[model samples]
Target: MVDENQLRQWGTKVVDIEKQALENLYQYIDSSEFAQACQLILQCTGKVIVMGMGKSGHIGNKISATLASTGTPAFFVHPGEASHGDLGVLSENDIVLAISNSGEASEILTLIPVIKRMGLPLISVTGKPESSMAKLAQLHLCIEVPEEACPLGLAPTSSTTATLVMGDALAVALLQARGFTQDDFALSHPGGSLGRKLLLKVSDVMHKGDELPSVKHDICITEALYEISKKGLGMTAVVDSNNTLVGIFTDGDLRRVIDADVNLRTTSIADVMTQGCVTITENILAAEALKVMDTKSINGLVVINEQQQPVGALNMLDMVKAGVI
Candidate 1:
């Protein structure tokens, strides 16, 4: 068992080692032909195929996912498997991204002949630019680090970090080049919170039809209060002459009116309603509506159409039910 002090010291030392390794990676970023490789991937009409061996293969899997999610279509292929028969999955139109620390991984080396025969564009990411794999590729993205974070200096640690970062750099470059939007990302991640944040709209959650707590401007505050209770929205919109929304009344206003002894039975809702109430459009995103509610310090809002007519209404509870809160 290690003492607390020993654990803390070891943690600190590891952090420092990794930090220095990352700093050394910046030199490779500046000098490497990363730009040329990005240009090649952007020009490719087919998917990008990332190939590697062992530890590099694991990093390649994550890289492929990041690329596909961001904007580039990419997949991971094991170089060892490719040598047997999986090379058929790749095509001349696809761009191959090969990753290796020493730049001489044997499994990866075996794919060079097959890749050459297929006439596919090759991009190699390696620490040694002069290694056989790097020399064979048309573009080389150097991911060199001065040393590994592993104390033994044999394990792939800092080098893998640099390779992953380089993969991210390429993905983001392609994402920007393609003008990918938040909606595009949402489409790809529909099951996650990212999709919820981007795809959830006010209309998707807002209560519609008779579920809206609303009253005619001439109705007494007592009747409006009854509507708020029935709709359970904690608020009610006040509409006028042509059924166009004119004002709103909330639970906060009820407390104020009670102090002044305003007659809920006799007073028209317009007399106690809040004029110029904030409203949102049906097409607006629920997250944006939540922001508006936060900024205005209100819990409920009326949903309006493009013509400025109330179409629906909702409160914080509705947002919670729709998982937009």
Candidate 2:
């Protein structure tokens, strides 16, 4: 049986080791070689071709994805596959980013001569600066770590963490240099929740026309309650004779009326409604509207026009349905 305390200590030790590995990365990031790598990537006119072998390939794939998503076009290529005609993907304008912890992966080293023949710029990432791949590349970024976190010293642990962090540092530096924006990021990730939050607007999720729950300010409390129940938004906007917004009535107001023993049949909604309630414009982002709701401690909002006319209504449930909450 596994000892729980021993397993916990082992896991904690791995985390501590990786944490130190990341801290050691700061010195390399502050070096001139790091700036030169960023400048090379920034100046490249084509996609970044990232290549690696074994576990480094897995990390390389992730680094490539992050670079692509953050404005630097990049994709991972297996070093072994590149020798078998996959290298045809390369062009004169593209740059190669090679990753190997030891800087001596035979598969990658085998392709170095061919890469040199094509005159493509090569950037190598490795823990050993003196290794063949590092010495052969146009530039080398070191990710040296103190030691492997694996007790047996066979698994690539601290070194891999340092490599991944270095990749992130490069990607983020390029992202800032290119002035990448949230909208640009949303364009690349349109299918995710983050895309919905940044790109979706209040108009896309608001209920308008006949679907909007609204009642006249002079209407009786019972009639306003009926509007709220029929619309299923837990609240209704109170408008005047000209259809301009005056206030709002919600389930909370109904509860207050019940406690005061007010006559729902005779009381005008205007007398019991919440005046100057939270409102939003249709063009605002749904995420911004959520902020307004959260800041005001309310669950619903009335979308108004320049004339303060109730044009639409939305609630927390609507936000959830639209995946904005």
Candidate 3:
């Protein structure tokens, strides 16, 4: 039977070793080769083609995904698959980032000739700087770790962690160089919640048309309450005869009006409504709308068109449902 103490000790030892490897990554990023790698990807007009084998190949796939999502166009191609007709994806203008711990994988070494003949720029990421693959490539990035966390020094452990960190450093550096914005990142990640929060517009999540809670400014408070209740937005827009927004009446205002003993049946909405209430444009991001509501200390907002007419309505609940909160 596996001993609990031994299991915990091994787990802790592996994590501690990997942590040290990550701490050592700062030195790798501080090197000139790191900067050159970023510049190469930034200036290249073609896509970044990443290649590797075995465990290095798995890390390369993640690196490719990170680069692609963060504004760099990149894709991973297995070296073995490259030999089996996938090499057609390579172009003369593209940059090749080859990953290998030993820097001498047979599949990768064999492709060096084809890559060179095509005149593509080669960037090598490896543990051995003096390896043939490093010497053959135009640039070499060292992901050398002091030791593998594996007890047998066989399994990829610290070396893979260092490589992954180095890949992130390259991706983030390129992202900053390209001036990539959150909106740009959202466009690439539309299915995720962060993408929804950043890209969802007020018009996309707001209640419009008949769903908007609105009433005439001269309507009695009792009539405005009906509109707010029917629309279910907790507030109603008070519009003038011309259909222009005049004020907003909310549940909070109603509470205050009742406390003051105002006659709801006789009072016009204009009497108790808040004039010049916080408003937003229909095209603004929902995240921006959240900020507006937060800073104004309100729970709802009126979305207005260019003519300043209430076109839509939304509350904190709408934002919450849309993942903008």
- Candidate 2, residues 267-312, lDDT tens digits: the string is 9999999998889999999999999999989999999999999999
| Candidate 1 structure quality by residue, lDDT tens digits, 1-325 | 7799998987888778777877876766676477778888889999899998888999999999999999898999998788788888987699899999889999988888888888899999898989999999998888888788788899988888888988888888889989999999999998777788799888889899989877999989999999999999899988887768899999999999999999889999999999999999988899999999999999999987766678999898887777776
Candidates, ranked, lDDT:
3, 2, 1
lDDT of 3 by residue, 1-325 (tens): 9999999999999999999888877787899999988898999999999999999999999999999999999999999999999999998789999999999999999999999999999999999999999999999999988889999999999999999999999999899999999989999999889899888999999999999998999989999999988988899999998899999999999999999999999999999999989999989999999999999899999999988899999999998898886
Question: Model 2: runs farther than 4 Å from truth?
Answer: 1-27, 191-193
TM-score of each: 0.87, 0.87, 0.90
The whole-model C-alpha lDDT of candidate 2 against the native structure comes to: 0.93
Candidate 3 local lDDT, residue 45? 94
TM-score of 1: 0.87
Taken over the whole model, the C-alpha lDDT of each candidate is 0.88, 0.93, 0.94
Whose TM-score is greatest here?
3
